[model samples]
Target: MLARVRRNGGTAEEFIGRSGPGVQARVPVVTSEGANKVQDVRFVGLDGPGWLLRGTITGTGAVPGSTDAWSCGMRLVGR
Candidate 1:
């Protein structure tokens, strides 16, 4: 799973939130000038029988821009 949060400092500004899911053995983060940033998310899940992966993203704010997104995926190695 991977998630991110971003906010703008103005009233009329905006905030965004994102999330997703995947099979990953490791997550990497990079830092520079005392700030941490996400480098990347690597998916390492192997394809096998009944393997499933899913993800969802949601956001809310004062404005009507709030929304949500969902997705699902699966694999059947042998059926």
Candidate 2:
């Protein structure tokens, strides 16, 4: 599985982790844009068999930009 965060003119941080009964690992993320910051993400699995990922990100560069985006709902890896 792959996750990505994109910004208009600034950089983005990245973090990857595995959540399951027998899976525990931290993966590194690579960035393609210049001066883009990247970091590892941390997530916790809930008691109801669900994973929750939360983090904060800051944006830089000129404001007042417009863009369209699409997203998929969170899903459990294994059930």
Candidate 3:
């Protein structure tokens, strides 16, 4: 996954969140001109018997001031 991001000129950080069933990854985009930009994305996945369910949070919900991402992640894992 990280490799995929790098292939497109972006960087990713994978981390384990406190309550999710799987690891969460954040891909922050690097502006070629000068500024560092954060991508509003949180990918949460749950490994199942024969499949995996993945969820993504974007927009303001993926930023520091929102709980929508966490809530959605929990819902995905809980399923």
TM-score of each: 0.20, 0.21, 0.57
Q: Please, what are the lDDT tens digits per residue for candidate 1 over residues 1-79? A: 2332222211121223332223221223345677654332223233346865433221222113333232122233452
Backbone clashes under 3 angstroms, per model: 0, 2, 0
Clash pairs, candidate 3, are none
Model 3: weakest 10-residue lDDT segment is 17-26
lDDT of every model, 2 decimals:
0.29, 0.29, 0.59
lDDT of 2 at 48: 54
- lDDT tens readout by residue for model 2, 1-79: 2233233222333222222221112333456765545343233233453644542212221111212121112334564
lDDT of 2: 0.29
Best by lDDT: 3
- TM-score of candidate 1 against the unseen true structure: 0.20
Q: Listing every candidate in turn, what is its Cα RMSD in Å to the true structure after a full C-alpha superposition?
A: 12.1, 12.5, 4.8
Q: Say which prediction, candidate 2 or candidate 3, comes out ahead on lDDT.
A: 3
Candidate 3 global lDDT: 0.59
Which ten residues in a row are the worst by lDDT in model 2? Answer: 61-70
Span of ten consecutive residues with least summed lDDT in model 1: 5-14
